[model samples]
Target: MGVGDVSKRILLGRKLRSSQLGETLLPKRIALPVFASDALSSVAYAPDEVFIMLGLAGASTYIWSWKIGLAVAVVMLTVVASYRQNVHAYPSGGGDYEVATVNLGQTAGVTVASALLVDYVLTVAVSVSSGVQNAAAAVPWISHHEVVVAVVLVLALAATNLRGVRESGAFFAVPTYCFMAGVLGMALVGALRASDGHLPDVESANFQIIPAPGYDGGNLTGLALIFLLARAFSSGCAALTGVEAISNGVPAFRKPKSRNAATTLLLLGTIAVTMLMSIIVLAHHMQIKYVDDVSRLRDEQGNPMPSGYDQPTVMAQISKAVFDNFTPGFYFVLAATGIILILAANTAFNGFPVLGSILARDGFMPRALGSRGDRLAYSNGILVLAFFACILIVAFDAQTTRLIQLYIVGVFVSFNLSQLGMIRHWTRHLKAETDPAARRRMHRSRMINTFGLGMTLTVFIIILLTKFLAGAWISILAMCAFYALMRGIRRHYDKVNLELAADEEDRFMPTKVHAVVLVSKLHKPTLRALAYAKATRPNVLEAVYVSADDATTKALVQEWDDRNLGVPLKVLYSPYREIVRPIVEYAIQIRKASPRGVVAVYIPEYVVGRWWEQLLHNQTALRLKGKLLFTPGVMVTSVPYQLESSQIARDRARRDSERVKAGDLRRGTVRSGGRVPPGKQVHR
Candidate 1:
């Protein structure tokens, strides 16, 4: 075993056959953690955001924290219901992108994709950073090292996900479920205590929230209150960030993929809504005062908190209050909160790569992204997502509030467009069907989609109005970037496809086939090239060599005659010690003489296995081929003679390919001349 082979085996584990891919299909239990962790984890901090937003209008505004939570829950459930329809209608895992493309056209589709792409990247950044922030509450060291810790967590999460979905799910499922139980358990305990009038005060209960400018005291009513509610509702909508992931990852489910995914989505929505509402209610009951700016929170008589005061998150405060009698309960909730925040980002890991594969397969992204690695994971997409997420974490210093501002913009963009597309989807299907039952179902689905569109559109506008200036524009800019990039890639692929498309004129042949073999020595590689050229039986065959040294040229001419070679040998002299330019000029001259003729420049090349050996040969021939490839009436063929080392490389490739046996990987099974070959080839 080679060192590289050993390392790869250690990194990816022993390879599984393609047929075992079914083992990777997620069961409902596993799929929940894999896809819904993000939405569910919102319980940890979403309530804090609600209170913080309302804090801008003083503690009096805290009266409506539960109301904002309800509104956010409504939007979230509506989105989940709409996506359930999407999963059933299009279970191929293209999700919103596919629906938008098929119904609203490609431009709209790419726009959604771009938004989702940016959103997924932010999902990782925000989730990991938030998780670290939660941890910082329990461990003071983490607060000072937030960005570094978050970046490290992102990398570790990415590595875990690279092990394929099922494995990562099994690994993450425990923490995710524990988090759900801990938060829900805390909420239950708090409710019981509140009913008995025994609920304890939170850490921030004594602090009075001072309203920001223009919203002090009774300044929040009418238009001001309406707008404040909208802003708070928008902030609370962060709970909806990962709702669409289930729709995007429907294919990851076990048998009856759509049904299983929909069930998981429902559970996710219910748990998330219950948790968000419960947390908000608990915070209000405990009188937890949370604020965007810690300094905005003061003590009795409007006095500022002493320099040493601390303000924990709303969830943190509620955890302390509800679990005050039992220290372990508080620690358990905090630990789970931190864990779920980190794992919530796994939803993106499961989603973005699959969506990226679909886009790549459709020619919007580099085809390399469409490939699966040894573990059957979209490794390229995973890595790309992690890299960008790390960049954002570093840029924002892993501050959740800052990253949160940029968080839901993309999700809402996708949400609005996706719902609009679903409505169109149902309308188009209704046109093709006539059964009373089916028509009724279609109309019902369309109604759901329409409601979803209206709700999402309203929230989308609110998000823009509320958070546009507060880091949301950064996400919008990112979406624009991805849109332009994908469009450009698609345009390139379309142009190439059109240019290479075969027409009847493609069958037209040149007046004659001219073959020129460029040789540097009387070696086996040269002889093999000569044989391959002769086998083709061109109308004209000749050998050409660019000679910079007169002595070597004389020796080669003498050797050619001694060998009695039938083909003509032409030696072009290069006074400047250049080889490629002279041969390119010769091929061009040949083409001009017989514009109707085709020139096949057969370059005798050496194929070496080791990287360094490749550098030792083919420098001149590579440059010559590059130049002649653009010449009219030319076909540059690399007639390669494989060296012994190539056997090792070929065997390595064969073993690597054995791990994947279906889809595009199976293309290797196609015999030569049947499928288009690799590398550049030009013909008139």
Candidate 2:
């Protein structure tokens, strides 16, 4: 194989046949990390956002941290329950898009798709950025270079995911589980210490929070206090961002896909809620002070924190205080938290491509996205998600706080729509059901959906009211743009489908075929083209040459006449030294003369296997074919004469194919006796 092929094989591993797709299906153990990492990892940063928002009203307002966490937990559980119905009903893996499309209309479906697509991109950005930010707490050097690190992390995650679902899931499952263990272990230790009255204070516990300009003295009441609490709740609701991915990825689960997926969702909700609340309660009990602005922190003497003071993240502070006696436990928690946050982007990497494939299959996206790559993954969609995510990371300089504002708007938009769609789905099903048992089940499902809709709708409105000016508008605009672009793509596909529909006119045969073979001189390639054209037995045949030099043209004509080649030689002089234009003009003339007939042009090309040799030959023929393809009633054919170098390439390919891969013999794809099986031969 060539260098490029070798490199690709090393990077993506051996290609699997289409039948091996079933082998790639994820079991519940692997599926949990693959689909739930985003929600689970949110505990690493979601509490920090809550504390940051509440710090606007000073440390006294921090008392509301656990309350906000509870509110977010309720929304998350409701969303999880609602999507359980979704996975059972729409197991084709369309998720919210399918639900909205089937129950509502096409517009609603497209809107949900646009929102989900935007949110997936944000998931990667926010997750990676937050990871980098948390890492900065332990490694101060990373703070200055957050953008580069975050971008590299995004690319690394994309490459890992390109190796297919099962492989990537196996790779990420350990770290995800480790993160869960570390955080929960730390929380457990902190609880034990607190019960014994031996828990140490966090580093920031001694610093006083300076309230913002409007909320001075932490004595707010009325609309101002309500708005402050609303803002804090909205920020905490980011925990609900990735709950829909499981519903979207139900097909990736093994046997009883919907049941496994529902179980995974329940586990995701329970674990995520537990971790989130644990972190918030610990931070509050330990008086962990996290703020957006460092100047807001005051020392015991009421002096502002030093300019260069680097405050650790909420997780970092809590871990340090909880594991103060054991240094290794603290670093382990931080390391696990950072790694899990980075791996959280894996959830989006999996969900985005599957959803993109579905969208492409439905004609709302480019067809190329629907195709599987050599590894049987949606490589195009993965690359697209990574690219946009890198752009966002760079554009915002990888600041989690800045990107967080643009994060949950799209998810909430999808959540509200998805919940509404489920309500309609159950209602429509109930209308058609006659059995009392099934009817009662449908009623219960509808009620759950109705409650879900109300919860999500309230959260959506709160997000809009609290975050619109805080960069949420940008995400809304992005969703609108995606919606319009998909609609336009569907329109173009439909128009092309109509234009290409076969009709009686397509059945009509051309009256005659006027054949013209392109020639520069008398040679084996030119003669081969002449013989091939004559073999077609067209109504008329001629050899056409573009002449830029008179003497060369005369010699060629003299040689042609001396040989008495049966076909007439036609020479077209080009004063501008343009070969393609003359041939295009001549073909157009022939086409215009007999509009109902076809003009066939034959060009001889030298096929060279060496990459550099290819550039040295076929320049003129390549340009000529490109021009002729655009002309109506014109057909261009390439008669290739393989060069000697091509034989070397063929030999190399043969040797490469003969080489045994790792699992060929074990899988019975190749025989140990060195004899080929009937249908197991490699064709490429």
Candidate 3:
């Protein structure tokens, strides 16, 4: 293997065979972390959002925190159940994008695609940002360099994921499960201690939150109270950001993929709901004080909390309070929570690639995204997601609250559209089903999806109203941009496809063939180009040279005559010392003169071994080929004359091609045409 290839193998680990893709299929245990980390890790800060929003109404409104959690949980459960139907119905891994497209038409599909794609990018950004923020609680240095640390963490996650799904899942599983155990364990311990009357207060419990210009008094009533609660509920809905990932990733599950995926989805929802509600309940029980700004905390003496006050995250406060009796438990909770937050980006890494592949297959995305990498991972998609996530992290300074404003919009948009699509899906299925049970099941699913649609739509509207000006407008604009771009790509593909449709008119050959060789000097490459052009037996064959210097042009003409080369020479002069445009104009003139003829422009090119040798050669020929390609009735071909240095390259190419995988073995090998003479090179 070449150095680059070896380096790649070292970085990505061993290259898996296409057949081993089945080995990469995740079982429920591993798949849980691989797909559900984003939703699960929201326990780290999602409740803080609820607390922050309620803190705006002062501690009096904090009573609504658990209520907001329950509402978010309800929405999450409904969305999960709705997606269960999606997995069983459209288990090919198109997820919401596929469901919308197949049920509602191309525009709706692309709309959902745009939303989900945006959501995936935000998933990485928000998760990594939140993770880094959570880490800052333990690593105080991270607070000063949060953005840089967050970006580095994102790159690390990208590298881990590029190693392949199964491998990355292994790396993330322990941290994810540890996080689950830590948080749920904290809740259990906290609850048990409370029952035993030994539960301690949170570190921030004594620090009072200053209300943000509203609701300083008790018993606030009417529209003001309703909007504050709605805003809190909408903010809390951040918990639902990654719920749809399981539907998007159904294909990565083990055998009986849909059923396994559904079970995983249920598990994800139950765990997320359990953790989210548990954390909120613990925060309330322990009187955990959280705010967007630490400076908002005032002591009982009516003074701001001391300048040295180390305001930790909600998770930290709760961990400290619940695990105060055991130092190791506190440390474990903090470490696991931080690691899980960092690993939560794995959800986007997994979903974005799969969704990108599905989009590529449908011609709504770049074809390159559809290709699996050396490890059977969609590497391009992962890189793209990481790149955008880093941009958001850097742009927003890696503050979770800033990034969170742009968070739930995309997922909610996808949720609303997906449920709407599922509603149509079942309605369509019910029309075709004759079996009583199947029809009944379809109706039941339709009812569930319809209910989900209503809930998500209400939440989506509330999100737009509450968060549009906060930062969601960026996500909204990004979604529209993506939708338009996909449509533009599809249009281009459709136009090219229609234009390339086989027809009898296209079958007819040119009435006359004219071949022109682009020559710079009377070298072996030029001679080869001339000879190759003559071999085609065109109706008209000539040597075309661009005269940047009179001396060189005369010398070339003299050599052509002395060698008795049969083809006549045509020279085009360039007073400006240009080579490409004059030849391009000549070819265009030839084409215009004989519109019924095909002008074959053969250019002599170099085949060099070393990378820098390419810079030293092929400049004129490359320019001429680029110019000639756009001219109608003209075809540009390169006749490469391999230099001595190219032997290494040629041998390397041959040997590298020989390293095909086991599946590449032909069942019935057949030999074709005999090898050509080494003197000639084919223009493929």
Candidate 4:
């Protein structure tokens, strides 16, 4: 046990039994929030974006919000149906990357991976930032500290996710459900109130929005209006950011993974569309006009009242009007909106890791990412997602509006690549199918993919054209950077594989083994090393020391003679008090003298527990081993002697592992190297 071991245990958490892996699987009730929150929570801000983009032309264009919402809903439904085919066809959890690489080509798969990675990062920044803004609406103290608040929330989410997916999923279920119920309930109540002539008007209804520099006072015709509308549609498509997570996480579901994932996707689309439409309708009835300026929203008069006014979110404004007389309803809507914003990023957390694991398995990422943790989950992938998401949060100061500019590009890239891949998959499969039924099934899949491809490609072009200068270029640059990075990693791995490959030229046998023991003074560690080297029965064995002082060197030589040591001691004189360099030079001299022989250097090392103890020892041995490694005929071996402090570290690790815990969900009754009992394979 040592400081390194302690740090590793702290980072990775205590090991869990293989049998307890089932405890990490999610039931649909919890999985919905875990995987669908990003899409479902878009209702809070999707309408805001729509209004914001339209506000560029003034509020007169707000009449078209429903049309845009409907278009987005149709695209979402098409994409979901298209992905149902994806999950069912390729349920190994590679998702878009797998679909593209297998069906399209390597280049397309890389394109999809880069897009998904960028999108996942934006998801965290946007969702957490939106959550912070919602919180600011309630607690003004948070307004000035939005970035700090978002960063803190990101860290908390990372810690929760590090506990395992099932745990975090269950924890987020309440907020997600509450958000759905609150929004749906408010919509219903507002509808009834409107029918009874008791509906309340939103605060924004009193204010006016000035059109942008070039517009027809928010009433326009021709290409200019169409372009503005397209930009709004692209922005509204932010609702689709997390839709692909279901396909990416198919393997995480229980039995019938593809079917479950497809069902979940349908549920996500229905809920998101319903919530989005309800909020838009309610906002229209409430006359909510969102403004980019918090101070400019006034009640027609020139007075800047209500402490300069902090404009609530689109959902907040709708909630304020719909629940004008019901304080609890307002609070419920506000609270749920805030909670869902935070949990929305959880979908990215779940998706990014799974996609990273797939990439790693495909040799595009570090192999450790493909390996499972104690929970049988891809923990490294989760950690990588947390790290990148935190970087984005800090970079953008957690402002959702600014972050939103970088959102849809990635999802669309993935969408277009995946759809194109699906089309290819059907074409390839249809070539082999002779039966009419099989051919018909493939044809149907192809048609679904063809429709999806057309829609996604159109949106992709819209996103690039409209958002290129409005910060979308940043995402494209990021995707390219990731693509180049992944390509470089693959190239490095290929080079290493070539270098390490075994061949006839490298199979030559060594003539003899010559063992050298590094000695400072005759101590227990040195004695142990000498004994161990002797047991190897090399062709020659000797003890070597470098002498910087004559008195100590003579005493050591006399002591060696007095003890009648079995091995001979060779001493070298050094003007400077250098130890590692002289030993390394001497080892090279021995190896150069006998080119065909192998020189084995046994260095005695002390194993200590405390971090500070490491600095006090092994300075020379470490340098010596590093230098000796380059010599062609030399091998370095460490002989470890554990000190008392090591026992404390070992005990600490054992306690942290919690081996005695009996009833924990992540604990199990299995012994070492044993299989789990029958009927205990799956966890709820």
Candidate 5:
């Protein structure tokens, strides 16, 4: 095996045969973390955002945190219910884009696709950014290097995901499960501690959160407080960003895709809500005073402690406060939370590529995205997602707080469109189905979708009203840009399709085929080309050679007579010693001389097995073929003559093909076609 093969085997594990893909199908336990990590990891930052927003009106407003949590939970449950219908209806895994495109019009579908695309990008940025911040809590060096750390983490996540969905999921499953267990365990411990009156106060409990300059007293009521609550609710809705991934990735599940996805969505929603509410309750009981600005949070002496002070993430603080001085608890919570946040990006990694593949298959994106990678993955889409996510990370400097404002906008956009689309989907389906039982089920599903639509529309309005001035517009703009680009791509493909259609006019034959053999010297290649041209029986046949030097041309003419060649030889002389330009001029002159005749240039090419041999030959032939291609009425044909070295390469390929044990083509198989020939130079 080559070094490349050896390295791949070590990294990707043993290759699985195409027939064994079913064996890699995820069971519910593994599937839970593989697809659910995004929603589950929201626990790491969602509570902090809730507390931060509420703290804007001072610590007393923290009383409203549970209410905001309830609102988010309602949205979460409604979305989950709605997506269960989505998976059942659109099991191809196009998610919102498919639903809107099929049920609504193309515009609506594009809108949903754009929203989902933006959301996927933000998912990576927010998840990795949050993970880095959490890690910075444990490692102070990472605090100052937040953006860099976050970017590296994003790249690492992208690489892991590039390995293929099942493999990536399996690698991250342990950390995801650990995070779920750790948070639930910590929440339970804190609840028990609160019940026993032995719960320790959070480290920040003593620090008072001074309200923003405009709100000094507790006198504010009516609309102002309502607006504040709405904004807080909007920010807290970041927890809902990954709710649709399971729906989007239904095909990744085993048979009965909808059932498996629905079950997984249920598990995701339950765990996410439980963890979210638990942390909020724990924070309230322990009086954890979270503020937006670190400046306002000060020591008793009223001195600014440090410029880049490392504040642990909200979940980290809760874990430390609840599991105070317990080393294992602290590290467990820290490790799991950080790891889960990083793995949360995996949801986007899986969903974006699958969706991209669907879009590409539909001709809405580049066709390359539809092609599977070595691991039978949509490698192009994965790389595209990673690139955009990396851009956002760099642009936002990896600040989770800033990125959070932009987080839920795209998700809510997709949620509203998908729910609305599902309503239409059921209405249309109901019109065709005659069974009463099926009708009744459709009606129930419609009710669920209708409720979801209402909830998501409300959340969408809240997000726009609250977050439009705060970075959310960026996501909106991004979605619009993606929509326009996808439409343009569709139009380009449509135009090409029209242009390439075979017509009666095209069916008419070419006026004539004027064949010419490009000869360097009277060798096997030149002789072979002349023979092939004669077989074509064109209207005209001639040997065309560029004379860079007179002696070579004279020797070639003399050899032609010595061999009694069949066709007439025509030589084009070049004063500047250029091979391509003179021949190009000669072909153009031939077309102008006899417009009814077509020019067919047959060039002889040498093929070698060793990489070095190619450089020694074919430079002139390649240039001659390229020049002939541009002239009107001309078609260039290459007749390749295999050298001894080429036989070696052919032999190597045969050996490699025979040695294919299992999944050699399915795993870690990068293309090796564009190799340079040994001992020769070639044009680019």
Candidate 6:
């Protein structure tokens, strides 16, 4: 194997055959972390957002933190329930896009796809950015380099995911579970301490929140108060961002895919809601003062917080307060939280690629995205997601607050539409069903989806009203751009399909084949091309050479005539010393002369084994082939003259093919005889 191949093998592991795709399927245990990490990790920042938004009206308004958390929880659970119907109905992993397309037509489906696509990109950005921001709490140095760290984390996640789903899942499972355990354990300890009247105050508890300009004194009652609450709720609703990923990834689950997926979704929603509320209640009880602006926090003496005072995340504060006696527990919680937040991007890494594959399969995306890489993963899709995510992280400076504003807009757009699609789905099914038992179940699902639609629609409107000017417009514009792009791709694919459709004219043979051999020297390759062109037995045969120098051209003609090659040679003299343009012009002239006939151009090309050797040969032939390919009725063929170096490439390919891969022995793909695979042969 070559260096590149060895490096790829080391990075991605051994390539698996198509049949081993089943081995990548996840059971419920693994699927939970793979698909639910985004939702579960949201607890780390969701409460902070709630507190930040409420802090706009000062600490007194912090009393509404748990209320906002409860509201988000209700919406989250409703979304989870609604999606249970989705997985059961559409287990093909299309998720919202599939539901919207099948029920609401192509436009709605494409819109949902666009929204989900943008949202998935934002998921990676916001999740990784938030993780880095939280990590900055413990490692103050990370704060100055957040953008660089976040970009690197995004790339690392992409590389891990490129290793295939099962392997990536197994790698991420530990951190995800540890995060859950750490947060829940911290919450449990906090609750116990509170019951025993021994809970300590968080670091920010003594700081007073200075309300924003408009909400001074926290006594505003009217549209201003309503708007403030709405903005806070919208920010809090960021928790619902990744709920649809599970439905989109149902196919990744093992047998009884839908059931296992539904169970996972339920668990995700329950755990996420519990953790979110726990954090909010604990922060409120401990009087944790989280804010977007550090200046908004004042000390007990009513002085602004000192400069360079690094504020810890709400989770970090809670962990410190809850585990104040056990220093390792505090660090463990912070470490787990930070790691899980980063791993949360894994959910998008899995969902986006699968969705991209589906979109590609449906012709809305480039076909390359539909293809599996050596590891059987959608490598193209993963790379694309990572790339766009890095751009966002850099553009926004990896500020979670800034990215979070643009985050949930796309998700809510998808959520509302997906829920609407599910409602229509159940309605459509009910029309064709006569069995009372099944009808009852359909009615129940429809009602659940109807409620879901109402809830999501309300949240969607709230998000638009509250966040449009706060960078949400950018996400909306992104979704619109994606929608138009996908539609344009579909139209292009359709136009190409229509144009390429075989017709009666396609059945007719060309009137005659005029064969022309391209030559630059009187050599064996030129003679071989002449022979191959003659073997075709065309109606007209000639050897054409572009003469950039008269002396060399005269010598070549003299040699050709001396050899009596049995074919006339036509020399086109170029004043500009251009070889490809003159040959292209000649081929086009021949094609124009006989529109109903075919012009066959045979060019001798050198096939070299070494990469550097390739640049040394085939330059003229490659350029000529490229130009002639666009000429109507012209056929370009490469007559390869293999050099001695090509033997090296052949040997390398043989060694690579004979090399044994993982699982080859167990799969019986390798020879069962005593003969070992090439690399495994023992030498005494």
Instruction: Indicate which candidate wins on lDDT.
Output: 2
- lDDT string for model 4 (5-92, tens) is 5565575466667777767777677778999999898878888998888777777888888899899889999999999999999999
Which digits, one per residue and each the tens of the lDDT, describe model 6 over residues 433-543? 999999999999999999999999999999999999999999999999999999999999999999999999999999989999988898878888988998899999999
What 10-residue stretch in candidate 2 is worst by lDDT?
A: 675-684
Runs of candidate 4 with Cα error greater than 4 angstroms are: 1-15, 215-219, 295-298, 302-308, 505-508, 609-611, 642-684
TM-score of 3: 0.94
Q: Write the per-residue lDDT of candidate 2 for residues 7-74, one digit (tens) a residue.
A: 99999999988998999999999999999999999988899899999999988888888999999999
- Cα-based lDDT for every prediction: 0.88, 0.92, 0.87, 0.85, 0.84, 0.91
Which one wins by lDDT: 3 or 6? 6
- Where does model 3 exceed 4 Å of error? 214-219, 651-684
Residue-level lDDT of model 3, residues 23-128, one tens digit each, is: 9999999999999999899878889899999898677788889999999999999989998999999999998888888988888889999999998888888888
What does candidate 5's lDDT look like per residue over 73-143, in tens digits?
A: 98888888889889888998888999998888888888888888889999999999899888888877886
Number of the candidate with higher lDDT, 1 or 4: 1
Better of 2 and 5 by TM-score: 2
Q: Each prediction's TM-score against the native?
A: 0.89, 0.97, 0.94, 0.91, 0.90, 0.97
**Worst 10-residue lDDT window, candidate 3:** 663-672
Error of 2 at 388 (Å): 0.9
* Model 1: per-residue Cα lDDT over 489-555, one tens digit each: 9999999999999999888888988899988998999899999999999999999998999999999
Candidate with more favorable, higher lDDT: 1 or 5: 1
What's each prediction's clash count? 0, 0, 0, 0, 15, 0
